[model samples]
Target: MPNRTAVHSELYSPDSADNPSLNGGRCRSCGYVFFPPQRYGCESCGAPPEKLEAVQLGGRGTLHSYATVHLHMGRDIEAPFTIGLIVLDDGPAISSTLANRTDEGLAIGDRMKSVLVTASTDQAGNEMVELRFAKAEGSK
Candidate 1:
């Protein structure tokens, strides 16, 4: 068994065999996966919304692209952070605000893994958990 502290938050969906990903949607018609869940329909095939289903996404992927944020959005949002798209092995590109990781010395196509991070705090003094990507430990 894995030894770790469990965080209580809604950053992702409950871990279930049916829907493992907290924020992933898959099109039953076209097999296209989406991050942030497809509530309307398939973006690629324009299928009926009913054809979309929720899914649990794997934690590993390759860095498809990225950009550095120079401007600040809010005090909760840190500047000089990197944001990027990761191509998951399950066939979806997930956008994440990279945290505790650097864009330096890395390139597109490098292996990366998803991580849960405490991005900020809520008004109630609660930690806001977020999913971010970092270079896979074994990757260059």
Candidate 2:
């Protein structure tokens, strides 16, 4: 197998493709948890930036909603890709690209888990993997 690299290194680690962890932030003052971590003040309360602490959130979540894109203009990805809004078990809802190319058998409230999918290959022959959600095993 070729070497692998994460597309968004800051968001998640390049390893643990089977069971990934999300880089999130929590407000020390208001206990607000959020993903795609930021250094800015808490959006829930008026907590200062210093009160925000980095956290490793579980990559498991519930599929709240989803949509399939049939058309695309971007060069990075093609059309017929699916995006899902998942509410993490820890807290906060995040919209992420789904591992499935299309939303065929997907349903709301399905158990979801994170997985790394090969987005592209780097010039140095490294696989660029990106985090995406998929229906959990044995989940109906």
User: What ranges in model 1 sit over 4 Å off?
Assistant: 1-11, 14-22, 121-125
Residue 39 displacement (Å), model 2: 0.7
Each prediction's RMSD to truth: 5.1, 1.1
Q: Least accurate stretch of 10 residues (summed lDDT) in model 2?
A: 10-19
lDDT by candidate, in order shown: 0.71, 0.93
Question: What are the clashing pairs of model 2?
Answer: none
- Candidate 1 lDDT tens digits, 23-74: 5788999888887675788998999999998787777789999988888779
Query: For candidate 2, lDDT tens digit of each residue in 15-52?
Result: 88896999999999989999899987999998999999
Measured with C-alpha atoms, the lDDT of residue 105 in candidate 1 is 78
